[model samples]
Target: MEPDNAERDPLPKTPDPLADWLEEPGSTAPGRSSWLPILAIVVCVALLSGAAYALVKLRKHPAPGSGLTAGQTALASPGSAWARDFPVSTKADLDGVCRGWYYPQSPAATGPAPHPITVTVLDNAFKMRLQPLSVHVPDGVKKQFRDAWQPADLAKVQIVACVDLVGSGKPLGKCSFTSPKVTTVPFVEGIYQITAYEVATGRKLTEARVIGAEECPLVALVPADDVLHSEVSDRQLYDKLHALVER
Candidate 1:
């Protein structure tokens, strides 16, 4: 036992780095460590990586109701809500509107009308039996479509013709070829598909389709005339067929 009057020596203190740091200026109590900034940086990097991955995914798939597919871009007109220019590059691109057997253009065949083309409408509804409408394939329109492809010897080729539907499969009631009665449908509408094939080999050269609601949807099959009044829908339909030579 030490005497009351004797002085006691202080024990040697162990170094406490954490306690020293906590007691530094600007520190109130033990809180987050100095490494907290590094942790925050790691979190930010992870968030940025996730955002970049999402952007790539969005580019791969288009949003629904955008009137477009993954690779397709829409060419919209100012006042025409129902009309759009569709450019198809592959059979897959044309698959939605073209249902019947389709083939790629013949490798040897550069021009669609290297041979004579026969056009026909293939609607078999009972209503058509009473008033069958003829599909007139005008030489002028044919030349326009054929001109889009590489010119070939028009004198050398011969091909067979096949018929396809345009829009709704319903019978097209009487529509005036001179004055068309264009209408809109809430539910069902008519669509027409015009396909061309090589008569000898039955090879599909090209095809296109159009859609509209009209009492006489067959008006689209009629020949275009300068004196004939035309509707926007009818013109759009004709334009589609005229552009068929495009790959």
Candidate 2:
């Protein structure tokens, strides 16, 4: 008594075309490959971010003697940072008021090989009061001599450094001078340092013959042999001077 339609098996069910396409082997649906694109994008972003961070760090911490010395103070040297060591040292003369490597022991300078920089004086105490005088570096080797010197009120004054590329070792000492009102000079391009020390008066330095007569200090603009200067020319001293100035 079953109806023919009921008895007959339902016509083979038609497959959904969409379903067949989705279920088909080796078929690429829209979202199947989404993860790959996302992962690749993430990896590229990470690499770019890392490179950017590294570049920032390099700009923040420039190499020593660059625009900034190890101390973070700007350098007077025109180009990049540089340093040298002097093995031989000059003798300190006690006969005068003050003493140090004030003269270039080498020959005369025809050109500015070892540049002259003017170093301002500061008090030795932590107060670091300014001194009336400054140390002058000449482009040549001549030591300057004057007839008389005015007494500088400075005692136990902070030391200043003139870096000599050809000079070796730390300076043995510093000398003082008196000029009418040479409180400061417009900044010039060169290397410099400031160490601490106690020395007498300007007159003594002049009398001691520590400041060379009007002659160049080195053999040439630079020195051929071991010449004199100070260990203060090194990086540490460069940093200290900058700190003192900034503070």
Candidate 3:
């Protein structure tokens, strides 16, 4: 009796419901949802899609020379060619004619030599360089020259002669002077020898003359007489000299 009941095996104690649910392969608890794995998968896919879109956009807008965009190619071609084609000249002509010679005004007056003058022709103007001889051509004188030259703007004239005795070969105690005697003159539009003389002895080494006009602005000195004369169109000469000097 008591024996039989004890033998019945105290009714197999039922496992805890929560423990059974946890142990089961498939089970849904009160506050738990079954969509966690699916949500995780969706999040992963969304991240991957964003990453792929960014990569595609980056490929389309890559840096220059990346070989993908045409911008780099366009910049490389004609721009480079144009730079290669046109150049500038730096070294000026410095021959004896280009570099001036000296003459004595008075046969009795003896000295080393007068200042060596140089002239440069630019597209819009000409420059005169007189060294070793100091000629204080007053602003009034310059203005007079400009007026005489006529129809040219005198204000733009830039005269820059300095006294560098060490460089001068003249015996007149070496005084250097630079004067932008005239500017914007129709006659002086290009390179020309306006005047060459020794103020010390009043000797004239070269005469004043213009070789080129505004229509054609290139001047080259005649080898024999040092006379100014037009050689070619300024643009053509500029292009040629630009190429040569640039090289």
TM-score: which candidate is best? 1
lDDT of 3 by residue, 1-247 (tens): 3445655556568756466335455765555544565789999999999998975553332232322223321221221111111111112211111222111111211233212222233321133433211222224433433232121222221111111111111121211223333222122123343433221122333343333332423332222322222322333322222221112
lDDT string for model 2 (207-236, tens) is 000121222222211223223222222233
Per-prediction TM-score: 0.28, 0.20, 0.17
- The weakest ten consecutive residues by lDDT in model 3 span 79-88
Per-model CA lDDT versus the true structure: 0.37, 0.28, 0.29
Query: Where in model 2 is the C-alpha error above 4 Å?
Result: 1-30, 62-140, 144-247
Clashes of 2: 29
Q: Who wins the lDDT comparison? A: 1
